[model samples]
Target: MVIIIFHFFLIYSAAAVGLAPPSTYLDGCQPMSCKRGAPSVRFPFQLKGRQNESCGSPGFNLSCNNKNQTVLELPKSVKLLVKRIDYVKQMIQVYAEDGCVQRQLPNLTLSSSPFEFMSDYYSFDSTYKNFSLFKCAGEGWSHYGSYYTIGCLSREPGSYVKYTSSDYPNTDLFHCSRTMDLREVPEGLISDESNNLYFNWSRPECGDCEARHQGCRRNDTKPSGFECFVIPIKHMGTRTKLMISGISIGSFFLALSLSVVLYMHHLHKKEKDAQGKIEQFLEDYKALKPSRYSYADIKRITFDFKEKLGQGGYGTVFKGTLSNDVSVAVKLLNNFKGNGEEFINEVSSMGRIHHVNVTRLVGFCADGYHRALVYEYLPNESLEKFIFGDKGENHFLGWEKLHEIALGIAKGIEYLHQGCEQRILHFDIKPHNILLDQHFNPKISDFGLAKLCSKEQSAVSMTAARGTMGYIAPEVLSRNFGNVSYKSDVYSFGMMLLEMVGGRKNIDVKVEHMSQVYFPEWVYNRLDKGEALGMSIENEEHDKIAKKLTIVGLWCIQWYPVDRPSMKSVVQMLEGEVEHLTVPPNPFASKEEMRAKLPINRELPTISE
Candidate 1:
């Protein structure tokens, strides 16, 4: 009767605390398991507590086998061997036999649930300890892996122990920019056999339990959990509450302190890198600033080039005012150069040449690789703005503008070749490259790819080609196509002229549609049949100019560089009134009637959209 009354009293005490009956618990924790000797297994987790149905949350559930090895049923076809568990920190160490078979992957979902990952965006952790190692005789040397450390409450500098491979994409399964990262390794665990060694994992800080509580003692025999001390009834006083508050404050500050240290370390590295970049930028363009302007003036003139006009692949251009509000385009490079080659090149070319259709160079900024070239700012934008592609808006330049612009471009190219001491090849010539001034007169821009060669040299052997596709000379594709020469610029300019005439791109070609309409080939086909393109642009004078431009375009893109006329002759033709344009034979057509059409493999990279 006394025993029964004691049990009922214990039940009442538990009820007052909102504690459910032990029978309702998922942990069927035997009295022996509940003993202080047994390692701790907390709520939402247990040591195989279910009789037949089994323990814990549906997703986090796992069971211990007969010999005390934790067994996790990740899936019907998948199982991971749980190596160890840290109850105070809440983590489980498991070894997967092989990577999930992709199709039969385990579902470790926590979304809309209490458990969730730290990051919404999938990325490797910078704080987590990462390593790549090779097994002596293992399948592959230097096997790659990563692990993250987390801290619920702080204790010491090395107290946190990280968890990894807990969820999909968190481990090896991941994607980047709409593309999957496919791991390439044969089925089975990575093994190094020569030294007869296993993949050694870094030991976690979880060997000891959490710090500070009611008189806790370290349990060496159990080794993974704790032993609680009985709190004296008298000590649970006003002073006890204050003491507890102080400990909580200390713990909170400890975690905050660790974060502060990490952040400070990152800031230090950032400052160092910034200094290095500035120094390098100054060194690379060393010759430029001293020869042109003082450091004090550079700061004043640029507002430091801070008033940016635009940015391009070569560099960023800023608007600057100097000496009585004279507008200038200050070009600052995005990347640092090895030496002053690029600076010297820009200054040398712009300094020597003077033409009505060229943007004049005024000053330079070669202070380190922070190179910037100053030029006169044109009120009008690039030709790419006026015509090219399916232009929907109607600020129509019409035939008059196109004719004047084409003639101006021809003269610009002519000057680049003949006006300079040596022939200068404008490797890149496109609609976007054609700049306009206040008068809307076209002037060739972007001489970064310009190269100087003696006129006597019939063919210049180029190391590698640099130019835009659709405008890139055929010789760049293969030597058999043509010889790389100043005429290559003429070919690119010709394509630009045709695009202007049609008010859209003449090349309707694609990587997959290489066999379709090549601009030169398609134009030749149309002209040979004596048919107009039936485009939207119309006027008799415009039609006449379009026909002449097309014929000139065909002449410029001739198979052999030797066959193409000089830019001087091209200017005369574009500026001429009489119509005596000669038609050329088709070169881009089939070399033979029976041979298969071929796609050439060459070095090419896509520009960012």
Candidate 2:
């Protein structure tokens, strides 16, 4: 029979006590086989068929529950449900099943196994099945245990802790309990079985571990299956057990005390850390609060949403009157989407970049889930309405006023992209994004995708493409499309310019010849042919402004991101001669129609893109 000793070494090891041995294994068991149907007890563990003894160390011990099947009290702290234990490589595979993803994220427990394979003895077969080391979200997150699976797998945090079975009924894998993660093994040295664990030990199995060998255990620790130098147990010293029991009680009490002290110390440190985090959070979140407004205030302002002003991707806009009888446009931010970020973006940038041509963010509302923004009403609405709408708002503005509107818009955008301390790239810059005030002056608005750049950086990486499809620059969709830079905004503005001249969406796909006419291509043909620059406005000067805008806009919409002009140059061109305009190469013609926009050479491993 093999006697295994169970030893637990944690602060709470006393409460989780195991029966230590007074002597090593003394009798009655048969030799075990690797294929034995009895039960597989791998390295760092062993089991006596009948006789019971402690295993390896004072703490690395485990025992079969009443069934002599289910392994529990593993490392004395966690319960391990053993399936098949492999001895060739030291590991015990256990199952960790949680129902859903969100559920797994929070309370999922760690792998309940101890008895790690020594670094010198075993190394995980990493390349075998695509199983790599476990990674955490970051410093605040925890690493679950390393897993030896047929393939790579994702596991919850709290499953990996370097220290184990240092205490009774548990191990040294202490967790940060409802706090920071505590599951990082200094490195990925220790790996647990995905489902079936295996272990590698010194040359001989327990049978050969006789006279000179020690420390080899199967299920329990030293006294039971511990392999060590053989010493003769000569006499059975008997005795009075009373004094010994009292000493044992005193030791147990002492162990219990040490655990409490350590636990308290951990909590104190966490409290101090939390205090610092709160202060930092308050400072950052101070200016991010959504604007506040009352439903009654909304009713009075929007005139009960009466004017029937307009509807957009977000919500309805109504011209209204405030208590001071101030005329304002109340945008009842939609209930379905969270666009309050636009409110924040506008307010933050507007406060920093003050310009008369820029629409000011007056105030906002974040009531329950309801959000809204209040701004001084621009009775003229937007350029898109008059220029593109079926209605006759276009008849009201003659050529010179239209030219002024165009100049004002160009100045506002140029200021955002260059004049401000931070070069703000207004990603969404189209007719709809441009609002006009009472004096027929234009103010750039809607900066939901604005990217802030220092004087140092003028370019940035783009992810999934954004902005209106017709207005999106090629570089935004893929690097092969071109290098992404502030010029992408130039592309959108160009599309808007053509629309202002054509009196509708540039690429209509509606009028057959003009439908697929591809605005950029059509604009170039008209300018090169020099037949009135091909567009006619009711007012003659409107024709020149329209022609000038069309040529400059075509130049801005060039295919390569680099081929586009800076907003400063755009303002210059708008103010400059039509003859000075250099024609920009058109990259959107057959190339876009023929091939996939992105390069095929870059093979992204594992990423679905």
Candidate 3:
């Protein structure tokens, strides 16, 4: 029995070692669509006949219908044809097969599935618009302007379903009876004419993989989890697989003992090669300006990380003191498995930045897997503490100081945009990233999400949205708004500026009334109506400062990047008096209305000197 077990182990090892590599196993699961012009299916979405079950996440299976359309069947047997898939945004657009989305909307249920309606995924207060659906029997319903008739659902002649923005429509006037209520529908999803419905998924998050142009697969350790890896370019053909299988079977016993030894040696060589590559990169990077430190040096400078200042998604920051009595903040990067893009971005961008308003990179540590960044410590901490903290007078930096800080931040951003050899766009520009010195001077910090492009380049290509959700620009989330550029940073700055004025987050669910849920829109309405801002104002001067900042922020957050002002112009607007500034067009209007009003041929404003 012992001899037989040993022989079986040898045979298994030989067969495994001689078979084709794992890359060929995925060849059958490559991206495919039901028909031409249909959305291609890959990870997180698999076609039943075309791809293996392991290729897609649970509850994400798609199938081809009789008409060769990609069909997504919901829990209630409701089927919709897939129109498009935005892997970067994790969104899928679908429509009914019969060109009537409303007919299927009543039966569409996203529960028990990995997907959610787009409105539910965003959870923005503005996206919540409840409408009442009424079944009416009348030919004169067209005269009622407030209600919209569902033309497709009205196929039964006299009786048809009509929907209105009001919660309770005058049923008697139209001889109608309220049938159902559609709650929390987004404006984009309200119109039936488009016949398209949008959905978003959050499970088995593969957006990061898609953004990096990598392939994602289920982890062997778990059934539902996923891991990203480099995709091999070539796949073994059927003939190659057949030949390899034949050879393995023919020489199984002859090569059995040697296979195990060779496999162990191969594993050792791969690890050594990876280490060698990292060492080579570090050696070449020594020529850069920032001094490279070892892990031991990092421990000494940080005193074994005795005092942790803050922690974020990327890393943890500790307070440290240099040998020369210079106080510094040392950031120990997280155990990231990426290609060191974040570390390279921070060092390359901040090393070239010399402005007083931008943070200076003192040095960095890259010993094996451990990485750390050292910077001059700001005693006052971040601007977020002062603005969003208690309402005490001492904590409030006052309107004048706040204005000065805003100008300083603008100058720093302008320096990043135009002062450097290559234009640097800070993808994250919230109040939390704005550090304050002992004198309360604002300095922009954190370059992990920064991107560099030529100053002459009008736009920068981005695969995924970066920065905090509330501060991210519309275009970053969806390219339909416009190409991403320095204007993206301006939009984030605008959100932060508005937060400064509102003394709270831009999206505050704890507000007293629903009107104030979206603070920016509320601010716009007040300014448009020429009403007082209602914030605790001391006098006339303070009111003007508040109004000026509000208007400027509104201008910075225009829907299209082309409509936003440059950082240089923003700095001038901040330096000038409030009286000289004019209120920009309302940016909170509906998307369709705003697009129709704005010119299609409008050129992006040139960066002012």
Against the unseen true structure, what C-alpha lDDT does each candidate score? 0.58, 0.58, 0.82
Query: In lDDT terms, which candidate is top?
Result: 3
* lDDT tens readout by residue for model 3, 275-299: 9999988886653357778999889
lDDT of 2 by residue, 480-536 (tens): 655567788888888888777777787777655853367666767766776555556
Clashes of 1: 18
lDDT measured at residue 337 in model 3 versus the true structure, 0 to 100:
46
C-alpha TM-score for every candidate: 0.47, 0.46, 0.51
Q: What is the per-residue lDDT of model 1 for residues 36-100, given as tens digits with 9 covering 90 to 100?
A: 34344533344456422332334444565565555555434344555544444445445543432
Instruction: Return the candidate ranking by TM-score, descending.
Output: 3, 1, 2
User: lDDT score of model 3?
Assistant: 0.82
By summed lDDT, which 10 consecutive residues of candidate 1 come out lowest?
Answer: 192-201
Candidate 2 ranges with C-alpha deviation above 4 Å: 1-296, 303-306, 389-396, 512-516, 537-544, 587-609
- Global Cα lDDT for candidate 2: 0.58
Best by TM-score: 3
Report the Cα lDDT for residue 121, model 2.
29
